[model samples]
Target: MEELAINGGPRIRLKELPSRRDIGSEEMKELVDVIWSGNLNRVGGTKVSAFEKEFAMLYGVKHGVASTSGTASIHVALGAINPEPCSEIITGPISDIGSIVPILWQNCIPVFADVDPETYGLDPEDVERKITDRTVAVIAIHLFGQCCDMDPLLKICREHGLYLIEDASQAHLAEYKGRLAGTMGDLGCFSLQQSKQMTCGDGGITITSNDELAERARLFADKAWPRGQAGDRGYLFLAMNYRMTELQGAVALAQLRKVQDIVARRRRVGDTLTKLLSEVEGVNPPKILPGVKHSYWLYPLTIDTGIIKATPEEFARAVSAEGIPASTGYIKRPLYMFSILKDQATYGSSHCPFDCPRYNRRIQYKEGDCPNAEKVLRELITIPVNEFYTDEDVNDIFRAISKVARYYRENPKA
Candidate 1:
């Protein structure tokens, strides 16, 4: 057996893997048009509106509202939904805080449901159990570019009269049961952050087929001011200014045209890694659900402590030492465990949402709220998956991981 890289042995990979993102003349061309026009704001800019229309058309949606960030996109969705303040919005526990921050900002209670062990998505059963009379909506976050099991979620929401919002920030073109990630809900949110499959530095967009919801989303992103209405400066309701700049719009439009191909390439990399790692003892690749396609925002796996004789952190370290970038526990802990939710640190100790009179019951978040999520975090290992990665890059990753797993298996105590 080959000596372990972590123990002063030669590394499995000698050179750095591909990390460059796809960006080129297409983006530059769009930016040039925007600059030449001298319209940097979406109010009079062509690129942002064009990007929105094209994005909505791509998803077969009627409207797409562009925003400043992924968090802003979710906020736009929430603002459009117009949930009663202090109403509860249930969502998966394992996700970026962007998924939860909007709930607090809207003065709504952010309730977290545990994730499915296999899919790492919102568990419909757990979601149903968490519902209360105050529940107004279910924000189904398609975590890690894989759509949640939406059938049961849609059913539950329908029976309960709850609005379903799809936070598909990481899932650009992910599909579930013949439905795209963002189209399966009342409102769908996406991110254009630099790390996403497609990006415009930092931006977001919300899409919806419902006409009223779409109009509301558009207005909400621009502070509820209807810009197109002739001679109407009518500030409709409480909203925010989360509009996307013309520059971001330009890059986003270019990125949108290339996103489908980008996701396809990323899928190949993720699928290939899953296949190569399938037989590697003690290491389990991501569990892609039936009829679900993962867009591979990040390649996540788990280590079996029983068979590998090493914790996820230790195993990740070993793999990293072999020249493959690896990390344990995507978020270190569940979002609720963070002081923001656990300590109710919102509004300068006001904790308005948690302790507000509008919300009758005292809301609290603590450990063990989502056992499966916590357990999954403990065992999860993540490696970067990029569209630019070549066959050799993937093989090097496999080699490094295989070497680490073999060493841990043989040593029994390493």
Candidate 2:
């Protein structure tokens, strides 16, 4: 075996990984247009509306509401649904807090469901198990560019009479059985955050087929003002100012045009890496079930530590030292394990709503709430796969990972 790079041995390729958010002349041109037009805000601007329309059309949705951030998009989407106050929304435990913050902000309960051990998506059976009459919706977050299995989830939502919202923040243009990730649910939200598969620095959009829901989202996004009305009494409901500026819209529009290329390249690099890793003894690749098309935002994989005889963190550090960008765990812990949620840290001590009488049920978050999610977070490693990587870059990744795994396998006690 080749000497380990971390131990003063010949190393794999030392070239830098691609920069995040590959902006070019296209993005520059869009920015220039935004400045020249001087219509910065979405209130009376054409860029935001145009981007919204085009984005919605991309997913075959009827309407799209642009917002300031991914979290704001979720907030507006939830407000549009206007579920019974203090009701519960079920979601996966392993995802960005952005997926659940809107629930807490809306004064609603976020009940977490365990994820599939292989796919790292919500286990549909577990989601069904967690549902109660108080459950009004399910936010299926497609983590790491793969679409969560939607058929069973959709059936469960339909039977339970709950709205299904697809959190496609990481999954841009991903497909489950040929249907787009965001298109499978009642409402689909995408974040064009800087690190996502697509980006406009920081922005988000919510898409829906329901005209009424779309209108409500639009109203909620812009402070509940009636758009283009005859009378001056425009306030229909108290809502947030989650508007996206035309500049962001312009950049997002350009990004949207390039999304297909980005997603395809990521898939290519990720699949190649997966095949390469599969040849290694203990490394597990991100699972892509037969028909599901993963966009590969970040190539997430789990190590079979039983065979590797190395912890996730150790493996990550060794591989990173070998010049591959890898890390152990996605977030610090499962969403529920966070101090804010576990200790009911909301509204500063009051825990209002959680402690409020209106909800009428005592709520508590526990560490064991989603066991599978907990296990995965502790055992997973994330390797970023950007679109800018060439075939050579992918080959280097394969060599780096293979070398690291071989060293670990041979020195189980080390």
Candidate 3:
């Protein structure tokens, strides 16, 4: 193996984000104008109402309830289902903490399951194994902007009478087997954070086919008071304020119109990067499962530590040094790995149905607990595949990654 040296050091950048407002300046201005005219609440507002209607129609869902954020959307959706205390909600370990936090907040136990190595989504078999009489729901996260294998997951949920919640925060407009991601589950949640393909600076939406769920979601996000009920305007049920502002809704509505184009651009960049990465030694891009259209929120590539001289962390730092931004690992492991699980102040010590002390004390994870997820996390390096990257930028990233990979392969000592 021969090292590839660069005369001017590394050359690629990790992430070059696009301006959400840049893609839709005119529409964004219109939204700002609406906000300027004084309407910022979801209640009795045209922007909020229009956004909900348009978003629902786009996802092919019967109803959409806008919320403050993706976490709030999940919180409201989970609240609507109202699972019994200690009921198990199955989810993968690879997702953001927000997905599982809502389960804990709702007084439900989160059951960790392995993810498919190729898809990085919930493994139906693992989910089935984890299911028990106490299991009440399943949250299938569409990780990396690709929809999970929903057909089997849906079947598993249906057989066990489980509510399937689709966490589509990173997968807006992604499709699985011809159906949109959020529509396949009992309820779907979307994020409009700044980095997301569709953004409202900070906002989210929950869509569901069930009319009752939609209505309850609205109530849950709006201080638990039933909407449009006669007489009492005061809060009824105990609920947190997770309402979305009209301005956020307006920006989101405008952003939604360009979601398809944004997704397309990201896909193109991801495809280019994938092709380039495949040529590099010890690097493998994420595999696109059959019948899935990936929206490519983040193009993650795994570094084969056995074959490569450099560790994932080293590779990421080297990439960054070359001007490309890269990261080695994800946030803290599954919720079970968090200190909050042990603290009596949160969820209490004995709240876990399992051996609480043992669960909290044990740091070593089982081999198969989250096998694929663990493997990916250890070796994966992600580069942003946002709408901002141009063809030249993709080419630069490709050249830099290839040079680094070559360098590490030859210099086994370093």
Candidate 4:
């Protein structure tokens, strides 16, 4: 393995993200025109209503309610369910904190569950074990664009009479067993943040098959406004202002129109990278479970730490030095382990809605609460796989990663 010049230079700077305007200019302009008209609320607005209708049709859901963010969507869904305070919501701890934040915000407790080693999604077995009479819901996150094993998860939720909410923030347009990710659960929330496959700068949509749940979500998101009522009339119930703006809805509508092409390009790049990197020693492509159509939000590779001489950080730095964007580390740890959860002063000891003192204290994560999650966090490396990558760019990335892996294998530090 030949060592190239290892100067500190990023192959791709963060600022170089593909422009949303370039991808969906027409829709953006329409959104701007609507914004200029000064009608942004959900009531009696064409852009907002049109976006919701189109989005609902796309997802095959009966209703689609837009929210300020994915977190707010989750909060609205949970509020609509109206789970008892302190009731538990089972979810993976390895996902983005946003997935679990709504649980805490809803005055409910988040019960951490382990993720599958390969899929990096919630493990049904772990979720089953974590359920109790107080468990009111299960928020299944489709991590990194891959859908979880939903068949078993759905069964578990049904058996326990728990509300099933799909956190489809990353798995936009992904599928499992011939069913779309967002449509499989009782309520599904999607993110249109800057990083997601589709973006309206920042926004989210909640979809549901039940009209009652949808109406409840709409009310919770709009400060309990009566259905079909446009003007504010002193409000009807306690709720938060989580409505999406006209501009955001417009941008999102435009982005939605081109989602298929964007997803296809990402898959193409992912396929090329996976094929090229699979041959390199100590580098493993992200596993695709059967029946899953992944969106490739982030292309991840797991390193065999025993064979690789350099640490994940060293490998990432080496690749970045060669002008290929690379990163290491799992997104974040289980939410329970965070200092905010550990420090009672933040939310107060009584802040935890549940009464399981033993479960609350002992259930807190230890160093190896999830052995596979910890292992993946320590050994995984990720490279950008976006629609903007050209054939040459993909090739360059492959070469850089291969060179880095070969260098680590050949050079052993005593």
Candidate 5:
């Protein structure tokens, strides 16, 4: 048997991975138009409005409300829903804080449901079990570029008459069954952060087909003031100034033109890696559901500790030593385990929605709130996936991972 790279042996890969993004003339052209126009704000500039129209058209939705960031996009959705205070918004435990923070800011309670052990998305059965009279909505966060089991979630929400919001921040252009990721729900939110498939440095958009919801979302994003109603300064209701600038829109518009191709290339790379990993023992690739298309935001894998005889951290370190980037446990803990949720840390010790008199219930977040989510995190090891990977690059990843796994198989007690 050969020595492992972590043990001072030769590495499997000698060069860094290829660049994932292709930002050049197309993006520059859009920016030049915005710069010469000299209107950076969306209200007066054509870029942001045009971007919204193009994005909405791409998703087959009637409206798209642009915002400053992914979190603000969620907030726009929440504002559009206009749920009563203390209303519960059920969502999965495995996602960015952006998915949960909006519920709190809207004076709503965030109820976490355990994720499916395989897909790592909100388990429909668990979601049903977590629902209550106070529940008004469900935020189906499509984690890691894969769609959740949307059929059951849609059925559950329909039967209960609750709003369904798709947090598709990591799942741009991902598909489930015959529908696109965001179109499956009442409203869909997306992030265009630098790392995402479509990027504008940092931005977001929410889409919906319902006329009322669309109008509310548009107004909500711009502080509830009716745009183009000259001489009227009436503020409609409580809302935020989460508007997207023309600069971000210009770049996003250009990125939008290439997003489908980018996602397709990433799918090829990710599918190739998954096929390769299947031959390696003990390590499990991301479990994609039937009839689902994963956009491959980040390639996540897990190890059977009993067979690998090593912790996720140790295995990731070994792979990284082979000149492949890898990390253990995506977020280190479930969202509920974080201080912002567990300690009820918000509103200057008031805890606001959680502690509000209208809520009238003793809500407590604890370690065992979502057992499946916690287990998945413990076993997860994340690796980078890029659209620009060549056949040789993909083979390098396979070689490094297979080499490390084989070393552990030979030295189970090491």
Candidate 6:
């Protein structure tokens, strides 16, 4: 057929790929209410508490604790559970720094576990192997809005008496086998970073049904003070201040109301693009396991380099040349390979956490530790499937991918 777009063929001439974080009159109205209330911090504000209650109820949980950022949410979760200092918390190797920073913050060891190649999630078997006498918790991250297979993970937790937490930072309103994400675990945390489908610039929440954990999370998020209470505040637990502002809460509440529609649009467009790309040789769409409902945060396409004769970076360049925005890899490498963990460089060279004698094991972060994650990252190409993208935008992405794929297959170069 047609000539490849990378070879002087027509490109998707649009100035922008898609406009996301859609704010409107409704959002402004909510902000105005917060502004007039004159309460900036949630410690004495109404919006934060209202949003937390609504969000927790939506996930079928009894309580929610709003925090300053996603990392703060995790830190609060860890603090609430009080996982032993210098103990181990096993987590998937592939994720944002937020996933591991909390583990380090708690003076705990961050045990690296390989991910399931198909879902790019925590592999239960590897997780089981990583557990030890010091293993106190499991942080299962539902990366890119796709839930991890939770049954096995739950089983592992129950068998070991370890706490299981869900890092649903990228997975709002995502369901796994009819049950909503973050509900199956002991506690679930979500990020409201601007780039996420639901955002308030920067904020986070921790949800749990356990009354004790809920109480602790609330206290921890607000510097161990009894929030929603007046007079003679007592510091219950050793904690830090990570409170969300009224402004963030107002906008986040508005965004939360639109999450269902936003998630649906992303899934629809992502599925449609996958449907078209599936027929194209050398292109493999993201894998949605049986009974899994994926809320597409970022659409990942794995290219079979053997057939395409091109690396993920090269293929992404070709596609981008055609005006479709795509990136070769999500992160530079697995979390462990980074300097913070590799050389035990945390805590300003003291390595207090990793160096703690209670953490007796000599941790190392060499290559080949997480082979699956490493391989998947290399072959992965990420495309934004934001809610703002329409069918036309999806079609354009499809054509760009197809053009580059076929061209690379035939030419084996460029």
* TM-score-based ranking: 1, 5, 2, 6, 4, 3
Ten-residue region with minimum lDDT total, candidate 6:
1-10
Off by over 4 Å in 1: none
Model 4 CA lDDT for position 269 = 87
Q: Which candidate leads in lDDT? A: 1
Candidate 5 global Cα RMSD: 1.0
What's the TM-score of each model vs. the native?
Answer: 0.99, 0.98, 0.90, 0.91, 0.98, 0.97
Error of 6 at 169 (Å): 0.4
> Could you give the C-alpha RMSD of every candidate to the true structure, in order shown?
0.9, 1.1, 3.5, 3.1, 1.0, 1.4
lDDT of each: 0.93, 0.88, 0.79, 0.80, 0.91, 0.87
lDDT of 3: 0.79
Candidate 6 per-residue lDDT, tens place, 1-414, comes to: 556567677675446787657767777888899899887877677888899989987888899999888999899899889987888899988889998998888888999889989789899999999998989999999998899999999999999999999999988888888888888899999989988878899999999999999888888887787755678788887898998989999998898888888889888997898799989998999888788888888998898888998889988988888888889779968888888988888776597787788777777788899999998887789998788888888888898898888888888756
Per-residue lDDT value at 254 in model 4: 88
Greater TM-score among 1 and 4 belongs to 1
* Predicted candidate 3 versus true structure: per-residue lDDT over 205-227, tens digit per residue: 99999999887888888888877
Candidate scoring better on lDDT of 2 and 6: 2
**Model 2's TM-score against the true structure:** 0.98
Write candidate 1's Cα lDDT for 5-122 as tens digits.
8888999998888888999999999999999998899888899999999999999889999999999999999999998999999998899999999999999999999999878999
Ranking 1 against 2 by TM-score, winner: 1
How well is each residue in 25-127 modelled by candidate 2, as lDDT tens digits?
A: 9988988988898778877778888999999888898999999988888898898999877899999988888998999888899999999988998899999
For each of the candidates, give the backbone clash count. Answer: 0, 0, 8, 2, 0, 0
- lDDT at 71, model 3: 87
